[model samples]
Target: MVAEKDANAAKEILQQFEAARTQVGELVTAAEKNNQHFDQLIAADNAAGHAIINQAIMALVAQTGSIERAAGIIGIDNLNPDTADHEF
Candidate 1:
C-alpha cells in the first residue's frame, strides 16, 4: 500500500509538472511575439518612439543601478558598449 501511494504521488507530481511546462511554453511564445513587435516598433524611424523606449530603459537602469541588470530584467541581450552607444 505504501509503494502504491508513492507511485501515485510521483505520477501526480509528473502531471503537475507537465501542466506547468505547457503554461510556461505558452507564456514564452507570447513573450517572443511581444518582443518581435517591440523590435519592429523600435526599428521604425520614429524619434518619439525611440525617445520613449530609451527613456524607459534609462529609468530601469537607474532604478536597478546597472544597465546589464535592466536589460536582463527586460529580456534583452547583448547590451554592450558598442551596440548601446545610441541608446544612452
Candidate 2:
C-alpha cells in the first residue's frame, strides 16, 4: 500500500511538472511578443526624433540663408565628417 501511494505521488509530481513547463513556454512567448512591440515603438520614436531634428535644422538654414553657416552656428560643422555623415 505504501508503494502504491508513492507511485501515485510520483504521477502527481509529473503532472505538476508538465503544467509548469507549459506555463513557462507561454510566458516566454508572451515576453517575445512584448519585446517585438517594444522594439517597434522604439524605432518609431527614433524616426520621430530624426524628423524633428531635420525640421529644426531646415528652419535654421532658412533663417541663416546658408546651410554651411547654419551648421557652423549649430556646431555641426565641427563634428568629424564620418560621424556627422552617419548621424545625419
Candidate 3:
C-alpha cells in the first residue's frame, strides 16, 4: 500500500544519508592523516635546514673578524663591527 511504499522510501533516503555521512567521515580521516604526514615531512626538512643554519651560524661565529671585513666588502651595513659588537 501507499503507507508501506512511503516507509520504504523513507528508509532508502535514511540509508543514503548515512552512506554520505560515512563517506564524508572517511574522507576527512584520510585528509587528516595526509596532513599529519605532510607536517611530519615538513618538520623533518626544517630540522635538517636548522642543522645547516646552525652550522653556518657556528662558522660565522668562528670567522667573526672576517665577517666584518666581508660585510664591508659586500657593502652590507649590518655586518660592520662598529655597528653591533655581538657575534650574531
Candidate 4:
C-alpha cells in the first residue's frame, strides 16, 4: 500500500512538472514575439532620426552656399573676424 501511494505521488509530480513546462514555453514564445516588435520599433525610430539629420544637413548646405554667394557678390570674399568691424 505504501508503494502504491508513492507511485501515485510520483504521477502527480510528473503532471505538475508538465504543466509548469507548458507555462514556461508559452512565456518564452511571448517574450520572443515582444522582442521582435521592439526591434521593429527601434529600427523605425532610427530611420526617422536619420531622415531628420539628413534634412538638417541639406538645409545647412543650402544656407552655407547662399551665404558664400552673397558674400562674393558683396565683395567680401574673406571676412576676418579679428579685424572686421561689427556695429549693429
Best by TM-score: 4
* Candidate 4, backbone clash total: 0
Instruction: Please provide, for model 3 over 26-82, each residue's C-alpha lDDT reduced to its tens digit, 9 standing for 90 to 100.
Output: 434534754433244336556643443455444445355444444444456764355
- The TM-scores, one per candidate, come to 0.32, 0.31, 0.32, 0.37
Candidate 2 vs. true structure, TM-score: 0.31
Provide the lDDT at 58 for model 4.
Answer: 50
lDDT of 2 by residue, 1-88 (tens): 3224455544544554455555444434434764433244345556643443455444433333333433454456653333344323
> What are the Cα lDDT values of the candidates?
0.49, 0.44, 0.47, 0.46
Worst 10 residues of 3 by lDDT: 33-42
RMSD for each model, in Å, please?
14.6, 26.6, 27.6, 31.9
Q: For candidate 4, lDDT tens digit of each residue in 1-88?
A: 3224455544544554455555444434534764433244345556643443444445444444444544454456785433135331
Off by over 4 Å in 2: 1-5, 33-88
**Full candidate order by lDDT, most accurate first:** 1, 3, 4, 2
Give model 1's TM-score versus the native structure: 0.32
| Cα-lDDT of candidate 1 | 0.49
